[model samples]
Target: MARLDIKRKRVALTRELARLKHDLQARELDLEIQCRAMQDTLGELEESRSRYAELYDYAPVGYLTFDAKGCITEINLTGAAVLGMERTRLIGMPMSVFIDKGSCQLFFTHLRSCRLTGKKVTTEVKLAPKNAAPIHAQIISMPLPGGKGYGSQYRSIIADITERRHMEQEMLRMDRLNLIGEMAAGIAHEIRNPMTTVRGFLQTFMRRQEFAHIQSQLDLMLTELDRANAIITEYLSLARNKPVDQSLQSLNKIVADLLPLMESDALLHAKWVVAELPDSLPELRLDAQEIRQLLLNLVRNGLEAMAPGGRITLRTAVEDNQVVLFIQDQGPGIPAEVLPKLGTPFVTTKEDGTGLGLPICYSIAQRHHAQIEIETGNCGTTFIVKFPYPK
Candidate 1:
């Protein structure tokens, strides 16, 4: 009986040991599965971090972080590019160093407002980068929480508004041009009819032998009348509502056809005309006559701006899906004060200029959906007419 009882206890102990071993194996498998899931989650987190970094670095506008002391603590790649410096070098630099001399006070005031109010503040200032042209920047800044022993930090976003400002000015100029055009359209025909009658009577009188002694005098009056009529014709051209006959035409061909006339004008002025036209270019929807007139006006202006020995270059290029006509002259630059009023009627840099030429050019460009941009410096001035490709 004692031997049987000892055998039963041994069997029961073996069964209990086997059950514990099975439970331990199940727990090990569960831990292994969880470890794999954790590894996958870590990989996803790292990928998300990389994606965010790319978005921050390559944003269109600039991003900057300023510390409490008004120094740059962090800057993105775009900000570095805008400042014309490397990101590493811009760190910890005073932002005032990059601000235009005239805008430093304004910047300080903007900074102070954000810090004092601990709220959003905005300001427009000119950024004078060492290697790039001055940028018209609009900054929107907001205060951030500061750490222990530090004042309020700030986050700044900088946007380039140069193009927007230019567009506003252009719109304003267009309004002025339209006003002049309306006035010209109303009065041009009325003025030309009476002048025509006066010219006809003057010509008839010149033919009479009795008035032969005063023939020279009558001729001068006739000449003056003709000049007045020519001026009126230009005024009619300035009418912005004038219809344009646009067709698919080769700009290069038009330019080639006008080379002879342009050369003659240059020669008359004892100047040189050089053509740098491309062999081929995209066809533009344009009015042939108006394009010719536009080219002639720009070329004439270039020639007049230059000295006798100077050269005017007519260049045609394709840029950014647009055809660009460049009339460059080797002349002293246009006056700074006169640049803003360039397209206005009767505003001319030349003493004898009617100031009607450029206004007419502007009017034609608008009718053809083109833009005229001027680039002038001490070296010379270039008139750029950009014509967009057909939609």
Candidate 2:
């Protein structure tokens, strides 16, 4: 009996020991699975962090953080690049440092509005970086929550919009050109016919002795009619229906032929005309008469704007795949108010000017699928006409 009882106790102990071992093994397996899961989660987090860093540093739009005082607190790599500065150097600097002098007020206004409204504010401003061209940037700023005892902060995104603005201006210019062309086509003949009849009768009356007392008046009438006729001629030039006769010709040779005529007019105004024609230039398809008209108008316009001893430079060069003709003048630059309305009909800066010359130039360029760009400053003005190479 004692032996049997001892055997039962041993069996029970062995069973208990086996149960304990199973529980330990199960717990170890669970721990191993959990460790692997933790490692996978850590790897995912690391990868996500790296991706975020790259995105922030290399974003297309510049990102900047500012304090309540409008000082830059942080700048991403893209933002630094846009400002043409190192990221480490930009931090803690005033954001206004990079804004153009003329646009500083605009930036402050945007900053104040964002902070006061605690909302997003957007504005277009020109940012002038050191030794770089002014950049047109669309700035979007939003207020950020401040920590305890801290003032409000801001986060801003800046996108370069210079090209977009240029495109928009080009579209507007084309629209204006189309409108002018339509108006010209509708009015050219209607206005010319009446002027012709009036001028013919005035000429007939001036020749008779019965109307000799008012002969001066008839002459005046004739002069005014001639002026009116000149205006109508310019209007006709803007008509899109006018056919263009394009022939492949040397631009340099044409310019050379026109120089004597231009210089003759320049001599009258005491202005010096200089030709910077290259020895050789690519031949382009051009309307000889129209190009002559265009050059005459531009050169005369430049000559009229200058005082005695001023210089007018006529230059031609190849840039990219286009031929560029530049007419530069040494005169007071075009007025700010007048520059924007340059090609509009009846807009002129001169008192006795008919305001049709530039519009005619623009019309000619439009017919040729060319582009006209003007650059003016306090020093002078340069008119650049670019013609595309034949495809």
Candidate 3:
């Protein structure tokens, strides 16, 4: 009886140990599943962070974070690119260093507005990046709450507006040209008729012996009349409806025909003229007289700008499927203020200039469906005329 009772007790103990071992195995399986899930969740989070970082770095517009003291706390890749510097190098640099000297005050005012109002602020400022031309930028900034014991911060977005500003100025200039065109159309013929009559009578009197005593005076009067007539001709040229006779012709031939005259003028002015015409250029549909006038005006302007011994280089090439003519001069660059108003009527830098020369040049270019561009620096100035290929 004692042996049977001991066997029963051992069987019950074995059953309980088996049940405990099964329960422990189930818990281990659940723990392993939970560990895998946690690992997957961490990986997803890391991936999301990486995507966010990429977006921040490669955004089109610049993003910048400035401390309360206006020092750069953070800058993205685009921001660094706009500043013409590296992101790591831009950190902790003063934001004003990249701003135009003229716009430093404006930048500070923008920062003050953001801080004082604790709201979004907007400003247009010029950025002077190193080794690059100045660019116009519109900056929109929002005040940010302090974090990690840091003082107040500001978040900013910068958009390059240089091209937009240039377009606006060009539109304004075109509007002025249109106005001048209207005025010229209205008054040019009316004024020229009387001037022609007066010039004719003066010429008649100059040939008379009765007016021989005042011959020099008559010559002066005739010369003045001729000047007035020439000015009227320029005004007529500015008329938008002026006719142009387009013909398929070689640009090199035109330059060759004008070379002797250009050289004569250069010799008179104690300057030199150099022509670089290519032999294998495509024929362009052009108004020969208009092109000749354009070339002469540009060459004369270059000659006038230069001092004695200065050389003007004339070059023609085929670029980007367009015929390009370059009139380059080694003269003092145009004034910054005068650059934007180059094609506007009555805007002149010379003492005796009528200011109509460039306007007429612009008008001729427009009539020919060509574009005239000016590149001026401290060293010199170049007038580039581009004509599209004939279709």
The lDDT leader among the candidates is 3
- lDDT string, candidate 2, 316-383, tens digits: 99999899999999989899898878887788888999888888898899888899999998878999
lDDT of 3 by residue, 63-83 (tens): 999998899999889889999
Order of models, best TM-score first:
1, 3, 2
CA shift at 306, candidate 1, in angstroms? 2.2
Candidate 1 similarity to native, TM-score: 0.84
C-alpha lDDT of candidate 3 relative to the true structure: 0.90
How many steric overlaps are in each model, in order?
0, 0, 0
TM-score for model 3? Answer: 0.81
Name the top TM-score candidate: 1
* Candidate 2: pairs in clash: none
Clashing pairs in 1: none
Q: How much lDDT does each candidate structure score?
A: 0.88, 0.88, 0.90
